[model samples]
Target: MSDPTALLQHTETRYLLCRASDIGEGEARGFGPLAGSRRKIIVLRRNGVLHAWRDACPHYSTGTPMAWKTDAYMNGDKTHLTCHSHHALFDMETGQCILGPCLGQQLTRVNIVVGDEGDVFVAGPTEEI
Candidate 1:
């Protein structure tokens, strides 16, 4: 197969984020798959399920990213997600703001696809930012 990201144009808007192996268990990776404009999205595996979300925090104007460090999404206890900007806690499964200024808000979910070939991709059209 050709380089997946380079082949992404043929798939329209869908861009390959990474292979399943790249994320492993309880890991998250970022991808810029929106028309090559550096749109950052995060894909993570939690409890055997895969989730994709826009890498934007709900409390800020630009909606900052959740992780303070690279791929370090989970809190020190590994129980919830902690924001890099303000240390807000969010539910890993639901993306709900459990503690902090944005309580009751949620991180925007982005659709994802897992190809039979083991590659992961951003799926279909997403709500524009």
Candidate 2:
């Protein structure tokens, strides 16, 4: 049989986000599958690299957003991602929870692809999360 994995490959949807330049170093922005949808995600630009994560707080059973302010998901030092609700900290480079509640847990990393023209896109899970 043809490899089942190969058959299902490239099937996930990749949604276009914003330009790579839009998110500056040490900055982050939030996006969702649709307007007025509570399901959300946040992307960060650190050291000129892009990292995407589901905007969910593992500390909270309901999985709430990490930012207190819009698109402001970093700690004061801009070194790690912070959940404003309970101060859960996560490693921006790896999305692993480094401090606060849910320690050792991690922020769900989204599969993102940056185009040659600097456009950002998330592959898979196009529906409202």
Candidate 3:
């Protein structure tokens, strides 16, 4: 499978992020720099659906990872995906920043396919940084 970071390029690589059941409702988890990229992939389950986004935040010219620590993607109440660096809150469903520095902007979305066996794969090309 390709790295999640490269999904923005629309490549054909597919990297398994996790099983859909690994993340429970209202919880988010981070996976990989994989074998090609330096950014982690965020997988979360909200409202019984799974969503994937790049770990990068859209606030700067070069995007930055949102979490301050391992798997720390959610806000204090676990309601929104948040950039711990500046406390920017993002809507889990749309990846849109609802508050803070990058208001109205969005985190990069990764195309994910969940197999019948429940494995989640990020579709993109695998390239070395």
Candidate 4:
């Protein structure tokens, strides 16, 4: 199994995921299955801040995408990131799984940077960097 934390960290190349304004407060969106990975990159807005995460649930070995459909990365309440596969709930701020199958596990976070012009960019996978 791959180490989620090591998959995409400290890279030079960056991909523009979206504009910061594209995500509304409490909204989540999915970007690419970037750099040959099966999983997409998830970007969400919470309390006026933007966060980026790898869209793979920690329940399985290689991990699986959390959304059931496109851009559906949150639970109904929009209070947490939800894994549709097993209904796991992750804390929006810290990416920690607070409930469901992967109780203590956390989502892999990608480096996200918001420019002064409001463009949101994520660090590319090692291969891309």
Candidate 5:
């Protein structure tokens, strides 16, 4: 099996995942080609800012990829993201496990920067939090 941890450490090829405008304010979405691996990423727009986190739920280690009407938003509340598998709610701003069995645990944060052209790029190191 591939070491997820090491793959995360070495995956630094950030790509222009999407346009900032595409993700409306308080909306959450998912992007892929995450730094170390080829897994999908969960990106959220909270308080008018973009935040990216690994789509996997810490409790069950299930990959919650970006999909419409699925584990995308939190119970019609666009303010937070949710894992469809167990209804685990995560803070859009901090990617913290605000609800569910993984309370106190946080999703892996992906470093990204929005360019002046309104393009989102997965830039910088992956933080293991």
Candidate 6:
């Protein structure tokens, strides 16, 4: 898999961000340059599957690049990503804002595929920056 950052820098359509071993089960790490933009992304491992979504919180878009102070986490149930800024909970599988002040909204989903070699890479269309 190609380097994710380098892919972004080179404006490649897609690239690899992490190895499967880099993320522990039920944990999430942040990455960036989805679709070749500056926006950050949250790459998560849930129930043995790898998923990626825009890191911004829906309530106020406060995570990663937007607000460096905010903290986001996977819910204790390991089913959703919760933003500490406003307690908004997003569905882990779909990136939908399922609870809190922003119900009906969602974090932008980024297409990604997990390679047989345990690498994770961006796979499809990039969401708007």
Choose the strongest candidate by lDDT: 3
User: Candidate 6 residues 1-129, lDDT tens each?
Assistant: 988888666445557778878878788877756556766677887888888887777676554332234333665566678766567778788887788888898887877777788778777656564
lDDT of each candidate versus the true structure: 0.77, 0.80, 0.86, 0.84, 0.69, 0.71
- Best prediction by TM-score: 3
Q: What is the TM-score of each candidate against the true structure?
A: 0.81, 0.80, 0.84, 0.84, 0.73, 0.70
Off by over 4 Å in 6: 1-13, 34-36, 61-72, 75-79, 127-129
Runs in model 5 deviating more than 4 A are 1-13, 34-38, 61-71, 125-129
After superposing candidate 4 on the true structure, give the runs of residues whose Cα lies further than 4 Å from its correct spot.
1-12, 124-129
Clashing pairs in 4: none
Give Cα distance to truth, residue 91, candidate 5, Å.
1.1
Measured over all alpha carbons after superposition, the RMSD of each candidate to the real structure, in angstroms, is 4.9, 4.5, 6.2, 7.7, 8.0, 5.8
**For residues 1-129, what per-residue lDDT tens digits would candidate 4 score against the true structure?**
976666454323567789998999999999877676777888998998888888888899788888988998888988999999989999987999999999999998888888789888875453421
For candidate 1, the 10 contiguous residues with the lowest summed lDDT are: 31-40
Query: How many clashes does the backbone of model 3 have?
Result: 5
In model 1, which runs have C-alpha deviations exceeding 4 angstroms? 1-12, 36-39, 126-129
Q: Can you give the lDDT of residue 18 in candidate 4?
A: 92
Q: CA shift at 114, candidate 6, in angstroms?
A: 1.9
User: Lowest-scoring 10 consecutive residues by lDDT in candidate 2?
Assistant: 6-15
Better of 2 and 4 by TM-score: 4
What local lDDT score does residue 70 receive in model 6, on the 0 to 100 scale? 30
TM-score sort, best first: 3, 4, 1, 2, 5, 6
- Model 6 residue 62 distance off true place after TM-score fit, in angstroms: 9.3
